[model samples]
Target: MLTVYAYQKCSTCRDALKWLRDRGIPHEVKAIRETPPTVAELESVLSGTGGDIRKLFNTSGVDYRELGMKDKLPTMDQAAALELLSSNGNLVKRPFVTGDGKTLVGFKESDWAAALG
Candidate 1:
């Protein structure tokens, strides 16, 4: 089953949810702000995403800037990055979805269709 980690107020998350429903895709939604994914889960996401750890971050979020992750990303290791993300679910990317060994960080209808297909 597809698992979606999302924030309630995020438009992207809402869009993704709508997209999934419209497509009749089966998915389980989790409130990321209330319960963040674990390091192991993040690692799995990174691995399935072809090692693009940056894709796992909410780059446009306030948490990203407040933590100075933009400037410190280059120096961070996977473990450190996961630690930061775990500290605050808002720091992690929105509408994070995974299923059948596939990981998607954001809502892209075309991409999701292809992946699900």
Candidate 2:
């Protein structure tokens, strides 16, 4: 089963969940704001995105802006960045899904279909 870390208030998260349900894809949903992904999971996503750590972030989020991640990210090392993200779920992208050796960020229907299918 896939594990999806999503915020309830996020429309994108809702959409992703709906898509999964519509397809009958087995998955577990966790509130991203309360339970962020672990470093290991983040690492998997990092690897999946070809070592682009920025892809793992919710760059448009308030937390991202307030924390100055955009300016700070370039100077931060992988370990430090992952630690910060793991500690604060708000900094993570919505609809973070991981399972079956696959990792996906955000809610792109086509991407999800291709990955989960």
Most TM-score-accurate candidate: 2
Clash pairs detected, candidate 2 = none
Local error of candidate 1 at residue 112 (angstroms): 0.5
Please write out the lDDT profile of model 2 over residues 16-102, one tens digit for every residue. 999999999999999998999999999999998999999999999999999999999999999999999999999999889999888
What is candidate 1's lDDT per residue for 8-95, written digit by digit as tens? 9999999989998988988999999888887877888888678888999999999889889889998898889998787789988988
| lDDT measured at residue 18 in model 2 versus the true structure, 0 to 100 | 96
User: What are the runs in model 2 whose C-alpha is more than 4 Å off?
Assistant: none
How far out, in Å, is residue 6 in model 2?
A: 0.3
Query: Would you estimate the TM-scores of all the predictions?
Result: 0.92, 0.98
